[model samples]
Target: MIESKRRRRTVANIATYFVLAGLSMFCIGPMIWMLLTSLKYEADIVTQTMQYIPRRVTFDNYVAIWTQSGFPRLIGNSITVTFLTVTICVATGTLAAYAFSRFAFRGRTQLMLGYLVVRMFPAVMMIIPLYVVMRGVGLVDSRFGLALAYTSFLLPLFVWMLKGFFDSAPRELESAARIDGSTRLGAMVRIVMPLARNGLVASSVFIAIAAWNEFLFALMLTTGQGSRTWPVGLQLMVGEFQLPWGVLAAGGILSILPVVVLFAIVQRTMVQGLTAGAIKG
Candidate 1:
């Protein structure tokens, strides 16, 4: 019986490893392909035969993109827009979430419900109205305008997610801080927010990634490289007359660097926060 059980356990372990290995390949394969493609010569990329591995690897594409393709300016624009959106969402959402979680007021349920409803609609539906508003305010083709546009889409989700994290903390913690003479805002900043840090980081990561990768609004709102994001610039590279595969792949790799570095830095906190909220809430 013991020998039979050992055999079964070994088989199960092997199957699990096989499944995990396949899943890992499915997820990371494209990223590997993009990186490899970026390093290949344009000739290798355009050939009739598939060149899974490049015969020649070079940084010429990377150099060309940075110096010639307006990638640097687009990178700056994307960073500015994404950072501003994340900041606005995190700042306003955390405060709004605190209010929702801590206080009971008139129309509170309705207000929360309204946030949910607004977020449920397709983002494309809001484009026309948002365009009108941006145009009216002379914010068209501006980084701030794009950031604000992104905020409208991300804010509700941020508030709802952070509110759950806020709700998980005990009221007595704040009450105890109140007894010690901290103001409400002071207590939140000092006591409650510290406990909720992981959730905030995780939410910020999601918001930043969403804003960075958004193509439609970036294309519609910003006409020039001065305000256009990497996504929009990257799309333009695949033009009507010809396709620059090597440069496009290089741009893809470059665009992913910021997000990858960010995820690597805060991923542990993000994972813990995500699972912690699920368990606590």
Candidate 2:
């Protein structure tokens, strides 16, 4: 009886593994298709029946995209805006989170609620007003302006997420640091910040992804290649009559690579940060 039960349990485990593997493949199948499509020749892409595997995989699509599409400029603009936005979000969010988590001042709860409300406000509603304000401030068509706008929009989310992580941190560590000789700011920098690395990483990833993919604001605010991001550049590939599928696919794959690498690097920290808040709460 014991032997039979053990065998049954082992079979169940095998079945579970197969199910999970299948699901993972299903999720990743489109991405695999995109990569394959990006490498296929333009003629092969328009064939009668879709071929899962490319008959003749060529680097021409990538090369064409690089040489003809001005992807380098788009990539540079994306990196600049994403990096700047992430920096601002992380810096300001950490400070705001620390304040919200560590202190109890007048109207603190109300202020936090207000921030949440601002986050919920539709981007569409604010776009016109934001454009007008940006024009008034002479910020239109500037990378700095776009970064500032993204930072403001993303900061509230970072604050909410980081605040949860900070609240989960042990208060004793800060108290002990204070008792030893550290000021509040010093303790935060030396003790609290180190403990919240996971949270910071997680917040940075979120902010980077958002800023990198932002299109609506970038489209309306910026006019030329100087400020145009990858999304905007990709949209430019769609002409009046025809769209270059291969080039578009190549551009998408390239655009997604950095974010994928980033997530792979910080995935562990992101998971820990996300779950730590839930467990602590």
RMSD of each: 3.2, 3.8
On residues 173-249, what C-alpha lDDT tens digit does candidate 2 reach at each position? 89999999999989988888878888888888988999999998999889998989999999988999997888888
Clashing pairs in 2: none
- Give one digit per residue, the lDDT tens place, for model 1 in 1-281: 99999999999999999999999999999999999999998889988888899889999999999998789999999999999999999889999999999999999999999998987877788888889999999998999999999998889889988999888777887899999999999989988898888878888898999999999898889987779999999998888999998999999999999889878867788666433452345
Clashing residue pairs for model 1: none
> What does candidate 1 score on TM?
0.91
